[model samples]
Target: MAKNQVAPIKGMTLPQLELMAAVLGAHLGRHLLDELELERVVYWSDSQIVIHWLSSEKQQNKFIKNRRKEINDLTGSKHWRYVPTHSNPADLQTRGISAKEFEDNTLWFHGPPWITQPQSWPVWKECDTTVLSAIENTETENCSETAKDKRMEPTSNVMDIVQIERFNSYQKLLRVTAYVIRFVDNLRKREDRNQGKLTAGELQRAANMWIRDIQHNIYSTELECLRSRTQHHLIRQLKLYIDPGNMLRCGGRINNAPIPTDAKFPLLLPGKHKFTHLLIQDTHQRNCHAGTGTVVTLLRQRVWIPAARQIVRSVLRKCVSCKKVSGKPYLAPAPPPLPKDRMLDSEPFSVTGVDFTGELHVKSANGRDKKVYICLFTCANTRAVHLEIVPDLTEESFLRAFRRFISRKSLPKIMMSDNATTFVSAAENIRRLSQSVAVTDTLCQAGTVWKFIPKRAPWYGGYWERLTGITKDCIKKVLGCTYM
Candidate 1:
């Protein structure tokens, strides 16, 4: 049997709700055992606080005492045991689930799997006394009349006047704070109220007011020690002193220098504060998005932020404009592993990459100019080159060049080339010729496989392409625009 109830709308603490749940479970269990004529029944609760309250002999308030008595009378302390919240099936009922989830859930129907095995049940451990004591203290205070009076007391702080973290820009915060101060002054004296644009003095006063509030909030103890003429280790080494306006300023050794007063004794600011971040951001923009070193130098001229360099670096790192202008491109991944043909150790030109270079003009014996092309065959492994000059790019012309190459070097088992029309046509012609009756049996048996790379990817056949470049360079140096 299972039962659940919604908590009262009047509001109740978590421990109070948990105790009420224990009472509900007790009522449900007692009715089930009475109606079914069961010999024994066990009760389980996820809240250790309720279990401790039921077992404890200590006196409790009327609210907890009454509920505890009802639960003990119905189920008895011996039947109560602790269960982990996650393993308790009632937890799902407290927090609703979708209809689909309710249909699929088995824990609600059968309880935790360990409920069938008595040895695996959760062992009872002592509840933390501190947690119980805190709950008791809270309950006691809530019942007292003085607590209600304390709650009615008004609390005020600087943040109640103006929230510093609400503004993104330091300049905007200063203007808004100045306006607030002006409005307050006008309320005090209706006549002769300052109106129109705010003067420079008002803005400066607002900035000082904000700075003083922030320092007092963060370093209240240190400020108190300084005011009482006592030493505090946190700011003792900085030689800090209060100015006439009651704002903390650094009293360094350079006070006697010819520089300005603000430069010699800059105002102290906490580096991790939100106002400090806004100040750094403002200075970064005013300097036309300068580097960290430049921003730090400019900021230190009037304000001394501890760990200024680190804070400036962090602030600059988040600037979108700087990121867009100075960010580096994504690095390319490493090159893939070399192909099997290129890694094989064999005779030079056994596996070759072939490509065509260019057309050259040479004088024939009849005093007529003829066009010639350079057919480059480079070793895939050794990078050896074998150049052959052909009259044209036709299959017959390239056949003769291929025959010359094989006759000079070892017969290439694999021929890799780009998918040029000349190479494709020559490969087709060689395939047809190899099956002809005129070809020798030895030549037919030792047939070479031609492999064409992907279309328009010259880098696939770079072995021969690079050799063609070198051959062109050599020709340029030797011929020097000569035809022959």
Candidate 2:
């Protein structure tokens, strides 16, 4: 049995492809042995490098090492042997041949002539050990150098108290950290075991402990200066001090103000720390997603984070509720270019756009007011217009107004209008009028085509619709509240 496949697009060395082929052959041999109940089997290949790799015991790269191990497990290394390229029958299949030649080829159908003779099998010499040992020593030196580099890496100075990153909410972190501290305290004093919902005092102690540890890790140099009575340039302007509980607090000009102590000297916190993120996030939620100014004002009551407004703004931006309430709407893509009818430079009124504008009241001959409508026609290319007054919105009235337009401006090849009911009825009437046998030859030969824009899209007929607006504005300005 034999199998073939195209090579991968990612280039690989020739030796790697050969070893992969050996792996495929080993699997095939194992399957054949189990199905046929054979006593023994052997694997053969044309590449000498693959034969040596199977027998070598030294370590190699991961790609070669893994495949070598699987090939050995399926077919023992001792059973694998080499065959000369000319004598190997598998080579004939890899190198192409004509169909007529392949049909009469005996080497492919039957093995090499020496295969039936037991004593004539090709002998595979063992690879030299001296060269292999040197290669192995070089690989060992490389691995040692990698380990030495890792050992000399620097360590982080920031001490995480209880894995603050694991908790999402600020309240949850405080509660969990408080429980851990209470558990440790109870271990020392077995006589007094305080067991119930955590009291306010216990939660307060947990918050203070967290703040103290964070300050110690990040502001160690500044704290050391304060203890030694020496001012550091970083905090010399802030007038920093250590309180009785060994916590860093800010000292301001309001030392004698008659107000709360927390407002006087709030706890100092680094703006970029993870704990500060959680604190700002919790304050934002507790205030019902208020504005940044409101959240910053509330946070300043107890903790003083440097660059507080900028940090609070970043945290608020990530809030899901705030995003839902204030996010901008998606922008629409640009409008398409104008259609062919509008772009062509044809004769005036060759392609005409029509629409209706009004309900102007006009006095009839009987001296009573009568309602009337205006029909406006615009040239698609020249933008010239023609107007006519009709008594009503019926198709008969519009057909008369249309006849008047064509008589003065000449017949138009294409007529475009909105999808109003009156326009639709008039288009059908015009089609029927053109098909009548009694009509004149000029009207029948013209074969005028009527087109309507898509329903509810007034912008599609803006060529004439804009004229309707201008005509109405002029009429409104000229005849304030009187009938014409």
Candidate 3:
């Protein structure tokens, strides 16, 4: 017979109560002994749910699975008995009562009196032993897989053809071609610097190694054998064979061609790989900003990269030196609409424009040679031009030219010229014309308005400037490059 034991249970559900009973019973059975120091354990709970869970074999939830395993491994579910809630004594500690009430409750101290009598103890009915199957936990799977064809080898048969037909210089092409060859040779030796040219054997081994590495990553499924049609279709179609050196190469086009051992078999490489990038940079730098065509031609002499032209172009596009050497031209914006003065109609010489043009060789009145600057005036509306000769750009000389222009073309309403010192600082001429009441009243009555274009804007006065060009051309025809 087991001694009476009443352990307090709190902060746990009814199912938990049963689980605790099962765990504690298992612990005592393994570690404790009864008559003749032999261990005997009997587990009891008020929860039918826990008793059913323990008895059942299936558990989907990991928490339940772990607990059930422990129970079954230590103490069998047959040892667990279901008691009515009222007969359970562990609830006294969980639901507290006054000390006087506790003292009055004998069940709280010694458990239900029937627990002492084996025949009087509660028995679990068939319905009590009935188990509920835990709904199988369902989870949605989100994994997605897509298949893509891998490019393990060059697709085109004419991989040897150079896309770019021309190169800027032969020396650049030769240097780049050598560098590419040197690069492959170094990789074959798997070392940096000073590795002499690779022989046919060494080159084949390197090419074989590269092909194996690529196939391992991309065409893993197709790597079963050389005869595997699904893998390396292009390599198979070429009737290529791996030499004793393990270098993949094609049989010669002719049965008997005088080809050197190294040149007899060409090495295979991916057209657009890290190796290609290295080759492109090497060739581009050696060629010194060679065109796409030139670089491609050089590259074709040795290895092939797919879309070689596009690759060369892309690589060169990033070359800082290339961009600097062949940059875009500076384009000025189109000529703006003509200003209000030029657009509107007026007298032919009403809105006259003026500019200095030439140093014509003229004979003086005394038959002495002299140089004179010609002030060219053009009508804004009619496009008629008048030229006046002046000995110098002085205010007096310009004033004389102005008077001559006015005398011949009539006193104009407005005059426009560039903001040159000769035109802007004409205070003496302006003062004489405005204040000289003694000389002639015609100067004051002319009411001529002088307008100057923006400073440093020679192009703004394009009307007269174009005329100057024409005048220069006509004079050049007659003078035939004369100094004058």
Candidate 4:
């Protein structure tokens, strides 16, 4: 937005007038003018005014709405949505990324940029304290349409005040003389209208000398007092004479000249009190020393102390109140036990196992579906074991595999595995060992216990996976194929 605009096209500058004239003049069949002639020609185009003057103050901006789609996530399924331009800080944060993740040295994106960024700089910080302060102070933010032009005015003013220019050899007297001439001219016309006209050249010369002398005397005295002073005082005097109300107002600015007072205090601290060093500095010192004690009391009544902001910050930084109560620490639940090397030291006393889906009735890597491999194991006290590559995991095939694996070896005493589907389906029947075909004495013979790891706690099955890897590698070494 445009913050301020004067009425009538004539009030605008050549560039501004040219912009309008180029765009709208084409509609009206007219030509644009130059800056040299702009001041002389007050082009009050009535038809142009009617055409460009907006009836409503604000209109819906569709460009911002179209730009909203740029928020889709680049790396993941995650995406961002349009927060109100004023509400969200997502816009501020999109500044350049650094090698360090989440480093605060870069501006944190606090919200959509309501302000312009630094000149020629594209990024803005997003942190709350920085961005909010930037917004509040009108310092870091405020991408005014004027900043590009702002760089020009101050440079020009400095040049004007300090640059070489020819003047009468009378120097300072030139200005004083000019001012006196106007003042007397004003006075004489008033006198002539009220009384009678002066006829003599001698009388006019005498009057001029008297008036000029008095003016020169007063001006010379003021100049003597001020010429040795800083240019600030000189310029300030000039502005006061030009605009007194502005010179006194807080945060007042005119033609790049800031008032001594201000329209607003940009440095005003936002907290309850100035953040200070003495209040915040970290210290080992206690409030009261090794005392023959009088009551050690905090000043119950408010006390004011003048301190630099650094001091206040230091004090607050180390304040006992801030340390004890300013924030809370987070503590999470304890972790689970680490995996063991083996469940049992000796064979069959304890055990570990692996479980996986057996092959389905689909083509295998070897181009056969006739065989399905289901594998399981137990630690052994006596060398007892079972293994199978079966047709499938149907109860009949499983039982047959068990029967075949144990045809000659000693029966297993303990078994363990991750709780998987076929095993889970058979768990109850295996526990009871009651059905004729299911209740094999070789499996149930030694009071064998079938253990399943705790639900969803695969971490306990670490050894099982390790053994599976070993077994797969062993089989690969023995057979040409990587899988059985």
Candidate 5:
């Protein structure tokens, strides 16, 4: 005979002990007897109550029901044979026999006395189902225990078959979470009017329940201690409390203040909670991609998440809009080396800047009002101005003004102006004149070097424009409100 000893767990009753023995017998039968090709298997237990539990059709309590199911699953009820407490050798180990007495005990070393004689083996009895149900029901009258059983009851749609993918960005994730929360809030409002707004406390409760559902096995003891009203170190240190919503909240000094519902008791959350990223993202978007301080302020108005400034700063740092809007301006490159002409000492009229002024009204010899534009040329080094009036803005009219200015100031070596169409065309015409040897010699005598400023930058030729402004003021005073 092969014997195994198992000490009863503390606080376990005789029925629990009997169930444990049946499980051990099943293990032995599978490992030893089945390997030896034995056909018959019997489970012997001294506790009749355990036998009744296995045979009972109606399960009265959740604990007994679960254990009874396990016992039947491992061994058939027909295999269970009742044994008197005195005849069962397993009881010797249960009551514990002295080592000196156990050295000659046949019941402990071999099998029970009745096991040697097949005719003397205990018989199986049909338990009274009604009497067993009545007795067990009366013994298991615990309201809290029943409530636990209800909580453990498996729902039909408890498991979701589909897979969910994580959101791309933290902001996107929080936006999605906020949308889901809003939807759930709507559903709750439809069910009951009091559930109008989904508070942070309520959201925290949902988050906790979700966490417990997935991580119950790992955090069972901690969560149980938390729910048991024990003096949890965290609860005392953080001033945390579970509201009627069953959410962990930071119970600060805001209870008496005239604050909003969210700030009164913000949800206390773990550092690694998934909602932390989403909350930061949501707050950022809510404030219209605001700065760290604004985002933190807005978030505090609704949820009292910790590291508010840090988390908001982190999320905002990665925010595309915030980066585009508030990113540091690139340091302007060091000013380029000034042009040689502007820096070198030269003759007063040797370098000149030329530009156009508007069409002014001048009385024609035919007694008809005519439009004429002014061409202003200034000596860049000396800041002297020469203004000439032309009829139209064509190359010929501008050439006339240019020839008159050159005649008055002699010829300039370098002349700079904006890249106006007329100036470009006149420069091209002058270059074409240089192709001829006669015209080239004439231009070489003038030593005119035409330079065009960058397009649309009139500030580059401010000297000539300033002279033009003064000429305009003088003309305006002379004309006195005349359309010129």
Candidate 6:
């Protein structure tokens, strides 16, 4: 038979905890938990607690009687309760806080279920909202826990039940509203108004989220705590991350906020708690309703939040300062169109574009040359080129070079050139003496297209432009002169 074995009753009182660290040869440190990160705390309005640890059943019973004597000796405050090891959450927290939180976030404390907590706490917990709807309508309590249930005669085994319920006047009005709407089934019509103030228990639901309590920071404390971690692979979660409501007052302006999306999770906080203007304003007003502070005081209690003119007014005014300074919303310009067809060089010189771009003083091979003009012809198909320089650009000089250029191949059906004064000039197009004055214009062939654009339209003639810029840079680098 196995004997029941409990761990030795070694209660490391605050001082003893420090001593144990030295015995184990580790440095012990003390630090207060941040307000937001604290959890599993209990508050008493008219009572106090005295703690003692007992190793055996005999000692446990003795400690109960000695508790009053100890309180009367050291601290006059006296209202005590014995909590079993299974229910003491502080056991888990003493091991983790601050730097340890990251490593231990997924950990949860096991509280031996308190029958009283589940029963009386339903006012806060089993708030499955369906009950709240019933509460709002003042209809037959949709919740199984009605006034009659609360008053049920208790057995001797029942524990002390703490009542934490607080109803709202406006909330009551909302219930009235809900009754009317549900009676007629007009939910969609008053959605905006209904969502705003009236709920079976609006703040009550929020209180469940742990945002509504601030007096002792009950819910905020729990949320700040690390009782839970997201199960996402990345421990991810989707949250607003910034409240459009408090917006810049806390984090910054709209421009600074990250856009909301479905995929985001494993959130850093404050961003997760953001609300829309209407929602946050309602929260702030709710905070104000607690009667402890002004709007600024109430807002400041949330520390990061800044004061606001009004949630609705601020959202409507559309402050550029707020948007630019913060993550604000705005429509962006659409992207430019993409090329539909893929194009490439088919052959070396089959498709050619010829253009003259110079007034250079290059020397001719003849000894007496004062300056030489380059008459260049480039093949669009092959991108191959032939160049000659002659100082003059007259028709006589042009035609002489042209004949030599045409000698290399059958006259091309399609040729491209720049829309320079010389290329498009009446003289160049007229052929000097034909009665039918032929114009030099772009023409398309089966394998190619010949075209010339007006000056400075480099983008339209990208092939030539790309090559020209390259050649121009080379010339400028070599000759110490800008491109012609």
> TM-scores for all candidates?
0.47, 0.51, 0.42, 0.26, 0.40, 0.31
lDDT of 6 at 420: 62
Question: Pick by TM-score: which candidate is best?
Answer: 2
Task: Give a tens-digit lDDT track for model 3, residues 391-459.
Answer: 988777887888798888897877888887888766436755666676457655666778988887788
Residues 1-484 of candidate 1 have per-residue lDDT tens digits of 5678878998898899998888888889989998999999998888888878888887788998899889888988989998898888888988878899999898888889999999999897774432333322332332343334443212224566888868999999999988988897899996999999999999987888878888878888877776565668765566676665566777665644788888987999999999899999999999899999999998888999988999999999999999899987898678688899889888888799998888888988897999898999999999988899998998889889998999999678889998878889988987787777777576666678899988877767776887898998899889987878
Clashing pairs in 2: none
Candidate 4 on 186-274: residue-level lDDT in tens? 78684544233433443433323332233233334433333233234432432211111111111223323343223222211112321
Predictions: Cα RMSD each: 23.2, 25.2, 27.2, 29.8, 26.7, 20.6
Return the TM-score for candidate 6, rounded to 2 decimals. Answer: 0.31
lDDT of each: 0.82, 0.81, 0.63, 0.36, 0.66, 0.37
- Among the numbered candidates, top lDDT falls to 1
**What lDDT does model 3 reach?**
0.63
Clashes in model 3: which pairs?
34-38, 204-247, 271-305
lDDT of 1: 0.82
Q: Could you give the candidate ranking by TM-score, starting with the highest?
A: 2, 1, 3, 5, 6, 4
Q: Superpose all Cα atoms of candidate 5 onto the true structure and report the RMSD in Å to 1 decimal.
A: 26.7
Over 1-484, each residue of candidate 6 has an lDDT whose tens digit, in order, gives 0112223387644323422222221111111123345432231110111222211122223334354334333322222233443344433544445766545544333244562473432121122212111111211222222333444222211111211232233334334434444444354566643434455464333322222222113223323221132122211121112121111111212322354321111112231222323333454456532222354343343333222434334543443443455545676567445222212445444455666655555444564435555666766555676775655776667666665675675345455666766555523443433233232332222222335666676555666666666665666678874233
Better of 4 and 6 by lDDT: 6
Sort the candidates on lDDT, descending order: 1, 2, 5, 3, 6, 4
Candidate 2 per-residue lDDT, tens place, 1-484, comes to: 7887677799997878888888888888999999998899978898877877788776676888899999989998989878888888877877888999999988888888888886999887764321222222232443344345543212222234478878899889889888987887799896978799998988887788788888888899987776554658755656566665566777675655687888887889999998899999999999888889999989888888889999999989899988888987897678789889887888899899998888998889999989999999999989998999999998889999999999999999899999888899999988887877776576766668999898898878887988999999999999978887
Worst 10 residues of 6 by lDDT: 24-33
Supply candidate 5's per-residue lDDT for 303. Answer: 55
Candidate 5 colliding pairs: 361-484
Residue 320 displacement (Å), model 1: 2.7
